[model samples]
Target: MASNRPAPEAPYEPSRHPETFGYGDFRADEGPWEEWNPTEDSLQQVRGRHRVAKQRGGGLARSSTVLGVGVIAAVGAGGMASANTGKPPVSIAMPDLPSVDSLLGNGSQETPAGSGTALSALGVSSDDSAQGADDAGEALRNRIMAQAERQQGQAENKATAAADQRILAAAAQAEKVAATQAADAKEKAAAEVKKQAEAERLAKLAKQYTLPTSSYTITSTFGQAGAMWSSGYHTGLDFAAPTGTLIKAIHSGTITEAGWAGSYGYRTILTLNDGTELWFCHQSSISVKTGQKVATGEIIGRVGATGNVTGPHLHLEVHPGGQATGIDPMTWLRGKGLNP
Candidate 1:
């Protein structure tokens, strides 16, 4: 029958060997084994030899044990795969190795050489590791605090800028409002000054002149059109009153003419210092002579319906610069601060 065993792998060769274990006479195929029962004396000699060999072989026993454990782990994994696949478990041949008691001694524990020195070299003390962790934590905390402070400062700067902008806007608005108020006040003040000046001018005119007559009604105004006059339109104002009503000088002036004329009947012409002529016509009598100087309000004539008569009244005309054309007497009187 054919054998079911797998082919043997190549023999392992140890790179180092003990000086006492020599392989000078070893033969694999020609070996004829002889069996003998063990005695206490023989076993003691074998144990003593193994101890001596283990001391001389350095870490050979430890290396063998490590290799054996690795093989057993691989075999276990293979056996599980075979069981799942419903196949026969693979057979792994194990080499002869020294017993654990022989490798270490009766009950002694084996420690790898220089293991304490290696652990000391590789490991850090608890104090140093804890201090490093604390330092890292402190550095992280400091970085976080610094970032927060920077953010706060930026926020403050932004707020300050916004506040400043608002302040500037308010100031600008206030300045504009103030300017408008000032302009309004200045304009009002100027208008008040103009009004006062006008008042003073009217008062002065009132003191300088007087009306021609009092207690009379205005019968005809200048520019009245009818067939009662030589001209197409009335050229003078008419004041109707009872006969013998006194007429007075309108202003300080010289009586240039005080006599009868054709259509005027009884007439008097007064010339002012400024060459303005005042004609008092249709008078019942003249009280001032020609070229006589009369003061304002002095009696100059009496009212009468003479010359193209219709009723008893005084006809008054005014001509500036002695021009042939006369202006409205009512307007001229009012210009001198006299209402009539």
Candidate 2:
């Protein structure tokens, strides 16, 4: 009870003794002393400086329990965010989207990167890339179709050009053939006309000539010596006259023969350009040889009765090409502008 008595107060000396609490031994005079103002960061630092909170258990087990509680809370918050977004649950959940490369495990061994990626390795902007890809695809398809159409058109044009060439060639050949045929026909017609004109001139000349002999009374005509002849008459004209009568050529032609023949006794033959022969037989005398030429009416032989003659007579004959058959001498003489 005696110690409880109040002592007397000392005099207030601020500069001499300044300590209020003994924690830092600081006094009011130590420099300008101030209390640590409690900002939120400062307060948290103060709380961190305090000791760990007391746990139900102790030591390492207590720390492990607190860590487990923190992990569970983080998982619950992420699940809530995913459900609210209405997106599918990711099979491989990653807390940090950019840090999802950790799923490949720590790269103690280098991991292979994807060969092809939707995004370029370089940070290029992907603006409008999908639209650009669609446009490129459409453009490629259109180009391919256009090329096919152009090729088909070109092939058609080539075929048409070839056909046209063939047609032109055929037309040219036909024209050439036609021209040749026309020219050949023209030449043939000209030749035919020329031949016809020549034939007309020859026919006119033949009309001017006359028959070498005339059909007249022939009691003894040419080719009448044998039984095959009519009446078995002599082969020439037999003009019964006394021997030594005048004989003359029937026409103005060369005399081919004047002879004394055994069968005919005396004979004279003449020749003309058209291969005609004239004869006078059974004459008195022959005035010319084999090749002697004589004119019409010129004396060549005379009438005589010689060699197998029945009586005194004169035999006159005319022949063509010296054949055995004789024509009428009187007609031949008149045809050459003379008379027998």
Highest TM-score against the true fold, candidate = 1
User: Against the hidden true structure, what lDDT does model 1 obtain?
Assistant: 0.72
How many Å off is the CA of 159 in candidate 1?
6.9
List TM-scores for all candidates, in order: 0.52, 0.31
- Runs of candidate 2 with Cα error greater than 4 angstroms are 1-233, 328-340
The digit string of per-residue lDDT tens for model 1 on 301-324 reads 999988987898998999999999
Worst 10 residues of 1 by lDDT: 113-122
Cα RMSD (angstroms) for every candidate in the order listed:
15.6, 23.8
lDDT of 2 by residue, 97-170 (tens): 11213322222222232132211212222343344445566777899999999999999999999999999999
Local accuracy by lDDT, each model: 0.72, 0.54
What residue pairs clash in candidate 1, if any at all? none
- TM for candidate 2 is 0.31
